[model samples]
Target: MLLNNRIKAFVELGKFLKQFKSTGYEKVNTVLYNDDFFDEMILKINTAEHHNGWFTKENVVFAIEQWADALSEKNLKEWLSSYQLDTIPCKTIGIVMAGNIPLVGFHDFLCVLISGCKVLVKQSSNDDQLLPFLTSYLVSIAPELNESITFTKENFKDFDAIIATGSNNTARYFEYYFGNVPNIIRKNRNSVAILTGTETREELEALGEDIFRYYGLGCRNVSKLMVPQQYNFDSFFEAIYPFNIIINGNKYANNYDYNKAVYLMSNYKLLENGFLMLKEDKSYSSPIATLFYETYTSKETLLTTLEKDEEKIQCIVGNNITPTNIDFGTTQKPKLTDYADGIDIIQFLSKIK
Candidate 1:
């Protein structure tokens, strides 16, 4: 009953927030540009988060509620019932955030919040400001959250359990050091796309949003492309080239220059656009200026390979219509309820709570 009530409340909140399209978005984006948020971000991005550009505040709200709705009836019930109900209490959940993508750690934040756990977020110093400001905004909506959620600068030590994300190297340490407790220690990963048949120009236009959103600095970004061998590259390039904005300015240019030198020196075939580069690498997630490639024979073979490598892939951002799991599988924008690690998040939080 309580869970149902909370869902209804969230829906109501969504309804109320829907009207905040223009002004609310403006405020959030404006605040992100302000130095206040960057104080936390500086630990990671130096001065770059501000320099790179902030996603419209509207993206944050849109993604969040998109997630809330994504975690809708059927999915929510599947996961929620996976564990027994009855408010589990006496919890303080700590989250080690990720900076690979904008507000990537928000899922863990939402999980802990929903599970009634005291959230002690050890934010990725890279994205310090976003989670803090986001938390503050949530508190504004649900004032009771002010008491529950506390964004901290203090290093978390004596927590019951933790949910952390880091590079494979850091994940090793987190798993060992945090081994004394139950936690979700995430290693590095990213999403990809499989362009089999036809993709429209508008779809490609929209697809560019996924590629350049954070200048390809996100885990959800399509760093790998799996196209059928017969598919000509020209159409794909044409569909995506208009949003060639990824190659401009400073930060992105640095990435282009650096990777271009390495490729030029090593004699690798690099398709360049000043900002984005396509190189032949097995790396699922490429550096800012580069992308990985593997030609596929058939969709069946591609599915088989992907299924085998499911553990490595994080999300799939393509133009496919069908819903997929073990895949962030969506051609359209990803709804919020979609999660990373494909783990039972609420259940994970519940145990700690």
Candidate 2:
């Protein structure tokens, strides 16, 4: 298939995804595929919770809507325009996906097929249903793409390159196993927010979304806060109180109960507001229903520390804190160009041959 055909198919997939949102799922005439696909998708969206307890309807729909907005012609063109697409040679690329958040590995899948290569995907068992269904819809829009896409449960073979996402331990295995292949091996990274004690109530509230969305499972979710010394938690706690209903889910509430008990037993001083817990810690990755915080003495000192630890960080959210920082609450809605780990995927794929 040609580049434009691939773009058209994804654009159509985006149109198909636009109908799903946190509010509800609605079928629209603009979707190019058959009614059967529309019906199947509706069923999948409804039953996503059964597949994975964390895959609630609201989170699944949020993921769908974000992708729907991203797959536009303008966005696709602008993201792909930086590379020389015609010079790329077709090859088979293997993808090992992560299921932390809905459609977490779709970008790699998109990059491989959009760059005129075949994709063999091995999905995380936690998130096996959604991507394959979407790929089927893409094939319906461009039947020629059928030969370029494959989903495998067996060992990965017959591929020229690979892109894999996993935790720090698994990444070491990936590095040793696929070390010889042209590959992008991703590991555990967490996002953080830097607060200078000058943020507005609105920005702090927006920061709540960054911390709570997807129940704080995604790499983009703000698991840690970098704050100035003497920062007050009164307003921070008030601003994020609106998200307290997150505790209604059994898995999240259970985690909160367990972690809170452990803290109390260890006599660790902590703060809580019924639903979420705030602990003073130095770690970037926090548990469910918990947010870790660290205090900094000076901006220069903090920046120097962060610069040295860039590999462990996925995104930094704040206002004017860093030149590369994402605005508060927008981390979950990453642009097509917001490559994870700051790696240019198209640039990676273009050189695969």
Candidate 3:
């Protein structure tokens, strides 16, 4: 399919996705697919928990709405314009997707297809349903994509290049297996917030969205906090109190209860607001229901430390910390160009032999 055709297909798919969100799922005739297919999609979204407990309807819908906003004509054109789109020899790119959050690997799948290449996807068993269902919608809108997209459960072979997302441990395995090919292997990275204690309640509340959204399962979620030594948690706790509803989910409550108990038993100091727990630690990857915090003695020293450990950070969210940092509440809603691990996927694909 032509590049413009591919963009149009996704734009249509975005419109189809916009109909499904936390508010509820509604089928509009704007999509090319019939009601039966749309109904099946609704069923899948509703029952996604059976496949993976984290794929709750609310989280899935939030993901869909975000993608719908990102796949607009303006966003697509602007993002693609930054790259050289001249067609390369259409190679098959194998993608091993991560399932931490809903549609976490969709961007890679979209990138390979838009670069005029076929994508062979090996989806994490945790997230097998949503992407394939969306892919089916894309095929219906543009049948040409039927040839371009493949989801495999078997061991990967025949693909020329690969993109894989996993933990640091699996990354070693990915390197061992796909090392010969031009590839992008991603590992775990967590976002952190640098707070100066001067942020307004609204800003801190927005930061809560970055923290609590998707139940902190995404790489973009803020898992750590950097604050002044004597920083007070009163405003932070009050601002984020609205997100307390997250504890209503049994799975999340279980995690909160377990982690809280573990911390108390270990004699660790904790700051809790009944729902979320804040603990003083230096780790970037905090457990679910808990956030690790560190007191930064000085901005200069913290910057030096972060500069040295850039590889471990996915996003640095703050106000006036640096122009490069993402604004609060916006980490989870990444644009198409916000490549994971800071790797330019299209550039890598374009250079693939």
Best by TM-score: 2
Off by over 4 Å in 3: none
Better of 1 and 3 by TM-score: 3
Model 3: residue 34 alpha-carbon error in angstroms: 4.0
Q: After superposition, how far is residue 172 of candidate 2 from its true place, in Å?
A: 1.3
Q: Write the per-residue lDDT of candidate 2 for residues 264-325, one digit (tens) a residue.
A: 99999998899998899988999999899999998899999899889999999998888899
Candidate 1 residue pairs in backbone clash: 44-126, 66-336, 67-336, 67-337, 316-328, 318-331, 319-331
Error of 3 at 79 (Å): 0.9
- TM-score for every candidate vs. truth? 0.77, 0.98, 0.97
Candidate 3 overall Cα lDDT vs. reference?
A: 0.91
What are the clashing pairs of model 3? Answer: none
Q: Candidates' lDDT values, in order?
A: 0.63, 0.91, 0.91
Cα lDDT for residue 47, candidate 3: 96
lDDT of 3 by residue, 221-314 (tens): 9999999999999999999999999999899999999999999999999999888999999889999999999998998998987888789999
Residues 1-353, model 1: lDDT tens digits: 15564444334334433333333322233332233433342233233346234443434444444444544555555555655545566477778887655567766776676666677877766566555654554554456666667666777765788888888999998888888888888888777777765877666666666666656666677788887786666676776787676565566778788878988999998776555677767669787767777888877887887888777787765555225732322322454455676777676765662
